[model samples]
Target: MLAAMPPSPSKPRNGGESHIRDRVRDRADACPGALRLHRADDGGLARLRLPTGVLTAHQVAVLAGAAERLGDGRLGVTSRGNLDLRGLPDDCGLALAELLGEAGLLPSAAHERVRNMVVSPLCGLDGRSHGDAQAWARELDALLCARTWTTALSGRFLFAVDDGRGDVAGLGGDVTLLAEPGGCALVRIGGLSWRVAAGDAPSAALAAAEAFLAVAREAGTGAWRVAELPDDRPLEAAVTECLAGAGVATSAASPGAVPVAAPPEPGVVGDRAVSVVAPLGRITAEQFRALAPGPGGEVRVTPWRGFVVAGLPGRAAAKERLAALDRAGFLTRPGSPWLTVSACTGRPGCGKALADVRADARPLDDAAVRGLPVHWSGCDRRCGHPQGDWVDVLATGDGTYGITVRTARRDNDDAQAQR
Candidate 1:
């Protein structure tokens, strides 16, 4: 008999009650951008959107300096391959925007937040994958920025340019372009695919996004995402027609490719590359400063809440740094508890929150909790929940928590008794 897999932990239960009205139900809330910060209960939160997860050494230094000077000396890596700085002082938004713009980080003022794009971190690093997606990312970004109509697109809209490995496409992006042999590619929007040549990938993606926006506007139901549009809209066909109009030959593909599983692992690859994972997607300002390699070395913030430091000094030096980071609990090791846990700010940070979920979660030994990933939420909105299957631990107004497991559909209660 084969060895049995580990038994998954019991799913957390939810109180099944919520007091805050759903802002995203009718339309997506304006997610914070570097230009526009969101005032959280704790402080101002600024999200720096990275379209292709690419960043230069100098850019990384700028971010580190900004975090130290303008906000709390900490950086939060978002699930969308973006960077976030919390606890920013009032009136710092404009300065942050100007600094980012000067560094070529802010390409467009109107389309900043709407530039929701994610790419595989190992795209160019791994030889087995297709050619670098960086050039294509730039092309698509230019198309998005130049198009005035794209300003109307919601911040929730997502675009993924994958290099045939299906890494980012699996994130359920609104638009995905998957590479194939013979210079052909597959473009997918809302789970629908269209076959197109490699050269047309950028235009095809832009057209698909435009099609989604048009459908959403026509629906007039305040739908923010393509999936929210009624089924009758037929978004896929509309996108295909739009691509054709753009002089892009297209056809449908059967049963699109599946997403791949490659967690961000920190180590020295070859003589220069080093991958580092930010624990629970958060890193201190001091940590970032230490890792900011100057010139020749670049940082690629990944959608997986980690960053790859490339072009290091030497293999031995890179390995030593990686080992140090590992010891400091920055690397995503096999049994690291941080990998299985995520939490949203609660308590003083948000007036809508019922409890200090992060504070409560800080004491839990996640190593003791196995199986499904666990996300702690102060309210039912479950903001920042992992895209994949996870166990939900929701706080109730009565100072207790309800847990809901996605796989088992089981519920349980844990009282927050005093120690």
Candidate 2:
């Protein structure tokens, strides 16, 4: 069983790695964890990582209770399957931590920030996936919390576990595990991949991270991601060496691109799952409770700022649950104008915002956007925007806004309208 551990003292860096530490460029990653509250314009913000986005109904109620009593009476979902509780008092850190620890949310204080993992939301429920990514996530998360050296990893580091559906592999994780057919898995770092037995996937993935840390320490560039590492280092070779040292057997495989797959549409998924999205990725405490699964069921928070309630008895139960969620003001079906629309925390909540983007977005309709996955930003920072080609609605000044279509090759201004 996972339990909370006290903070451990920082270990000393070796002479060779310490010498190059001064040359590191990227500043320390200060991403907030459950214990570390980030002070925002609205109030203190606490981000809790949910490995594989698994949360019991009781856990959901606990979080909702915490949000109502400690911070703002709402919850925000991140693209990485994490929850953000905002508008908290400055001194609410201990209270928040206590609430989370009691609910089994904070497994380890030292490893809280580094426990970032996102698995396919509809993995086993949809019956489209080959293996259980959630199981791998559980194993990997426990392994991460047990190891002390993993605390050195930045909070931004991510692990994407795909059940061969390709849904999360393209989401960009520092280390990725893609479940393949015939009881095997592919462990990928950047362009390189090593095929290993399904049972060894988690260990291989951990070894990959260990290798990256070694390479990063050698380069001493404070690189938080594999893409940021120096070009000269052969990361694939390092990972292979680590895997061998860890006694994980691997087979040769060519470097291949990660598979790309979009998230499931918002509605009933298959026979036992229901997918729903909060309008603009924000929901009130009552609305959050409405998403709770039945006893023994689990809710999987999607990377697309949505929720997937799984483990239903059958199709009828899923439809009934979906109807209840739809009645609760969640976007449960398709054709909802807010389906692809999103906005940042603008106005009073965000000091840098030029306008209340959410308020401004509340009035728009299908005609307002010509494409899907449109995002409204308070400014150029464009926080919480969706990936891939989409419309960018940027707040300019006064009541005016700028609209542009962004693609891989070009940015074309489509219109300028008033909010």
Candidate 3:
């Protein structure tokens, strides 16, 4: 029988609680990037940001090539639409930077880590969006790089640009720009929002970052994200003041519920596009190349660990591509078992991991296996679990497991012992 619950060390996160910080960290953020490779149990790991997850076919090929030559033969997709390369040698940093820079992936080395931004993947292509958030996302990325102070923003600080659909509005961004009617947008800083011209969204987002920096300086707590600030600090007032000082005009957003559509599933979007979900958030070099068939072709990597391939000749052609991808192991059909499972780089890749979570995930015969989104974590970090309600299958180091599920109807953690 399976059970749910782990010891405190491998506990699933209580959404109501903070990320284990009772006080400010009092140190620099150590989020790893292409330039700053993180030392993992499995060698140097690099996370390259794809702002809005847009990568040309050539860019994808370059990354896949790098994965085979410089490090592991696989590419890991992130919930935030970025890519990770693990198992690199210690001296591969310089070489990796050169390859990435040549591919136009690293625009500003100084601001690389702070470029954690995600845009509504379907914004420009679906035509249902109120604005071109894809364009806005790129513009914002450029603006963030042009400013030197933006580099001070924490690597964990996230900025989201949603095209009035609310798809990514609730992803816990430090700063969010939501599309509004009449070609305007709402800039949300903390709980408050200021109205800005659609064109001014980029600068306003930067202003929001500056505002966070200002408050962080005063708090002196080294708060990495807006939500992590001391409970006593007032976030709204400070961000408003920063915007005013930056000469960006503002108005409070109306207090009400924002309607967010469910994230796009695998299917033809509109008439000319289809989304392909990567199984278990892992896609290989060949798969990456397939997504970007020819040079100059573009693919939008989504926060949901999928790719939106647009600009097809027709619905038939899009469905044909989806079928081809499905044959090649990419999940192009809804309700695939792979959609509900995610695992971090466990075992040989992550020293902190207690077990090979991915290997363990394959053979679970329980009914709950496909009932809810389940993340198999080697340790407590649960690095890339789904955001909303789901089940967590955590491996306890001492030859057992813990299963925890948190949903609107129930929340419980139970311990499991091996037979």
Query: Whose lDDT is greatest here?
Result: 2
| Ranking 1 against 3 by TM-score, winner | 3
Q: Which residue ranges in model 3 land beyond 4 Å of their true spot?
A: 1-22, 231-233, 362-371, 407-419
Please report how far candidate 3 places residue 299 from its true position, in Å.
Answer: 0.8
Per-residue CA lDDT of model 2 for 115-172, tens digit only, reads 9998999888777897889899999999999999899888988999999999998777
Residue clash pairs of candidate 2: none
Maximum-TM-score candidate: 2
Candidate ordering by lDDT (highest first): 2, 3, 1
RMSD of 3: 8.5
Q: Higher lDDT: candidate 2 or 3?
A: 2
- Per-residue CA lDDT of model 1 for 305-403, tens digit only, reads 888877778888778778877766686355556666777777777778999887777424454446567888899887777665567889999999988
Stretches of candidate 1 above 4 Å error? 1-28, 327-329, 362-369, 407-419
Alpha-carbon TM-score of each model against the true structure: 0.85, 0.88, 0.87
Cα lDDT tens digits for candidate 3, 172-247 = 6788889888988888765556777788788778887887888777767677887555432345566566666666
lDDT of residue 375 for candidate 3: 81
RMSD of 1: 9.0
